[model samples]
Target chain A: MAKKRIVTTTLNGNQTEFLCEPRQTLLEVLRDNMDLTGTKEGCSNGNCGACTVILNGRPVDSCLVLAVEAEGATVRTIEGVATAAGLDPIQKAFLEGAALQCGICTPGFIMQSEWFLSQNPKPTEDEIRFNLAGNLCRCTGYDKIVRAVQDAATTWQDHYMKNCHEKGCH
Target chain B: MRDFEYEAPTTLAAAIELVAKHNGSARCLAGGTDLIDQVRVGRLTPDVLIDVKKIAELNVLEHGATGLRLGAAVPCYQVYGHCGIVSDYAALADSCRIIGGVQIQSRASVGGNLCNSGPAADSTPSLIVLGAVAVIAGPKGRREVAVEDFCTGPGKNVLQPSELLVELKFPARAANSGSHYRRFIPRNEMDIAVVGVGASVVLNDAKDKFVSARIALGAVAPTPLFAKAVGDALAGQPINDETIAKAATAARAIAVPIDDMRGTKEFRLHITGVLTERVLKAAVARARGEHVDCRIGH
Candidate 1:
């Protein structure tokens, strides 16, 4: 049997350690070992963004990342999005806007949208659609999903303004 | 996917030694966007996975007076992220932005795209037209291969076992030069190219006449083609639709596509001319002024 390799990563704001074989994907590690099942597995290939996670500030499909490659990296899965008190602004927007149906792809969409919003806080509708093209929603035909992202962008902007009293450049 | 020994060596020499020990059974993992899926689908079975991202030589991203030195492990996001490269090598950025999405670009590297050597790979045509070269290192030492000559077939390249692609080197941008890449796809995003075209052009100081040009076509052939004659035909010709059409005809003539689910041979043949004309026009516009044509891909 191949020996399992111990990998360490700052997962969801916590120092995480897990053992995985070379054959296992980060998606598998997140779900099977860490019990962070929010990052769902869709195509198991890179096509589906259901396994999306923010790794080292970049959104990536977890299924495409080898488990051992997470060593010393900072990873933010869907599990890390919501705070102790309540859901993140994007999550709240997703719920309020009814951006999900079937629910399998919601986590991935939220994670990807959060990262995109961080990059371009005042994104236009075309920009949102262009940036979020990797994330697919089979149920909503993407109108509601785009609306939800727009909703989050506006709310997140307001939330930011209320806190800092000015627009923060990303 | 079969279990394999994973090795991440921090230095070039150490990585070379580890891969050399595994002989031909070891595969280098740069970005794993294509590779991990290849393994998961049982298309490939290897005994070792050499994670090359840790090696400094494969992560060097330097743009200097001479040219751009893009490390093999530098992801696509980093390539497009560099403002200078984006302006100087607009075609490279054009293709990189559309290769996958942000998620795939964040993890996939341009060097890995070259190494993957798929016929439809988005970056190859741009690499060829931009005159990029692969800097490879192996136990036998180092050698450079032009990007146009790198691939021999679909899913194949000139790289031998244990040979590592260190970086892709591009010569400094020539004066009055501009480049652009665009592909015909059925969908707006998340699709492989049907007939991709990359074009780099140099125009007269007035930007009304062609000084010289380079064109490359993808997905319409077994390998990405450096359409030298197509570019040659447009040299000295006035930068007009009629002159560009001659180059497009030449490109379409050389395209030998196969019928597949993505596109029929005739469809690819027709698109070969269309994309060539479109990309050439965009490239000419950029050569006149360092502007990126966002309209090309859409």
Candidate 2:
């Protein structure tokens, strides 16, 4: 067998490092090696979005990515989206909008929605539907999920601008 | 899965050497969407994986007199958004756009899709219609093959074990020429095609008669099939509803769809008729320098 390789990256926001087998997937490293089980695995294939995570500012399936490919990159999972104080505004909106029934597909939806809102502060229903096509939610049927995204977009924009204003980011 | 050594080569020559040295026990890795799955399922057991993603020369999309040159590592998402290619060859762009979702598109490479050699591959028809050519390099140096003849059967290609599909070359349409692609799927997104049709047409100066035509069909044969009879039906003729209907009939007659979970043979043949008619009309409209208001969703 080949020697295990070291993979260095910023996880959530903190700098972290680990030694992983060359064949180890990002999903396996996160769940097994790092004990970050928040990143769930629904299907080993890329079909289910349950293993979605942000890699270098873009959302990708953790189950499909090799750990070595993520070297010198930044990663954010469902647990990373929140702060020490409370949930991210998107999560809060999901709570307010009741976007979860079984809650299995919620994390992936939230991560995807966060990435979507970053790209377009405000997106039309069609745009949201198209962008979120990667994610599948059986219990919600995407009605409440769509509403949650819209609600989160509005609220997050307001909150972001307010923070920028207070910090004089003009 | 068996343990394997991984090498990220910086140059195409280095990649080729690694592939050559490892020979039968080696495989080139690009996006890893398919490669990783096959490895996990115990379908492929390689002693070494040569990741070509680091080779800068294998990631370009260039246009030239011979044709459009797409490097092996160029991601599908990159191809889909390239305005130059999309405006000139929407068939290729449309094929890239509908391959899986954003994540898959971002990670899937055109070369990987072709090398995987699945019968239902969405990009095959687009390349077939554009008269695309495959550029392959190996221990024996390089050679080119028309995309139509690249594959021999399911999950099998004519590529040698030491060879890599380095790039794809497709001719740009001349004046009064245009190409269009259409596919039928059960869902609006994240679904494979039941049947896909791509057609290119060259119109005479008067825009009343077709000077030449080429039609390609996918998912109905072991490899992407060229409907030469259908192309013959439309060539040197004015494209009217009646002419298009005749071409559609010819296309259906040439196709041989198989029964599968995604579609029955009858349904695939039926949809092939509908899509061929739709794309042929769209190609004619494009050849006349008119914009197509794409009505189909997903």
By TM-score, the best candidate is: 1
Residue B50 of candidate 2: its Cα lDDT?
84
Predicted candidate 1 versus true structure: per-residue lDDT over A23-139, tens digit per residue: 899999999998989999998878879999988878999999998999999999998888888998989998999998999999999988888877677889989988888988789
Compare the candidates by lDDT and give the number of the best one.
Answer: 1
Off by over 4 Å in 2: A84-86, A158-170, B64-66, B293-298
Score candidate 1 by lDDT. Answer: 0.88
Query: Candidate 1 lDDT, tens digit per residue, B239-293?
Result: 8888888888889899999999999999999999988888898898788774554
lDDT, residue B61, model 1: 87
Candidate 2: TM-score? Answer: 0.93
Candidate 2 chain B: worst-modelled 10 consecutive residues by lDDT: B289-298
- Name the weakest run of 10 consecutive residues (lDDT summed) in model 1 chain B: B289-298
Question: Considering every candidate listed, which one attains the maximal DockQ?
Answer: 1
Question: In candidate 2, how many Å is residue A153 off?
Answer: 2.5
Q: What does the lDDT read for residue B97 in candidate 2?
A: 80
**Candidate 2 C-alpha lDDT tens digits along B64-156:** 566688888888878877876777777888788888777777788888888988888888888888888998988889999998899899889
What is the TM-score of each predicted model, taking all chains together?
A: 0.97, 0.93
**Model 1: reference contacts kept, as a fraction:** 0.89
